[model samples]
Target: MAAGAGQAPVVTNGIHTAGQPVELSIGLPHNLGTRIHLHLTILATSIIVFLSSATLDGAQAGAAMSSFIYAIPDRYNPSQPLTTSLYTQPSSQDFSARLAKVLVRRTGKLCYVGGSMNLANAVGGGTVDEEMEAFRAIVAVVAAEVTKARNAEE
Candidate 1:
């Protein structure tokens, strides 16, 4: 479906295994200063996400992984999740943590596996506005996937 007004357009690629929707991938608008791509692996217990920056030609590569993060729902209050990270580099971004926390809360999943590479730019890092756009795009696509997974369960 086309994005509504004031929404970032997302492109999704689904990869099924054994006729099951095991994996999903998507890319943000190519015109953005820092193109971001998201790949999701849906499991019975958790969902794993690989967040990356795209190449000039829109390939899903080129960014160096800066950190790995995970989040689990709080038993007492799932809305307040517990999140932590293992940084491979000093300049890791917190977008991964944000993504995990949001997903765990929204889906009420037991756990979420997520990590992000530095949004690479041939010139430099993306501007704040560009990065925010990327974040919004990721959230939008993830929410849609969560809905699809729930429907499949029904």
Candidate 2:
């Protein structure tokens, strides 16, 4: 669904895998000033089947996945930015987390992960490896930048 002006757009989609309904929604807010806001929610009929063989049980896997979402703002930094705040809901049960990570940038250009559909692809199997890999790939470029910034300070 389209968000109102000065608001973030909301994208919702779902799929059925292994006889389970998996739903995902991502919200991207605009003009937040030195901070970007992204909200992600994943819901499934059976959390286990939806997430596909995750090593952790429902709660653990949910928390872990939540962390991945919270890391996005920092992982995808925008030029010399100072701080990033992230909020996420990886599953039902009122489970959520907020993360704020410090960042320093050396480049003028901004980088963000496109093709959020990739996340849906990973959700099909719900395997820990699959999910983490997708999460890692999303942040890999920014992770490198963060590392470089840290090294420069040392």
Name the best candidate (by lDDT). Answer: 1
89: Cα error in model 2, Å: 2.6
Query: Could you estimate the TM-score for every candidate?
Result: 0.74, 0.24
lDDT of each: 0.62, 0.27
Instruction: Please give the distance, in angstroms, between residue 30's alpha carbon in candidate 1 and its true position after superposition.
Output: 8.9
TM-score of 2: 0.24
Best by TM-score: 1
lDDT of 2: 0.27
With candidate 1 superimposed using the best TM-score fit, by how many Å does residue 10's alpha carbon deviate from the native? 2.7
Off by over 4 Å in 2: 1-88, 92-118, 122-124, 149-154
Put down candidate 2 lDDT per residue, 1-154, tens digits, no spaces: 3345644333324432332333333222321111111222212210111121112122322223332222122345443233222333335112111111211232222222111122222233444564443333223323343444335446
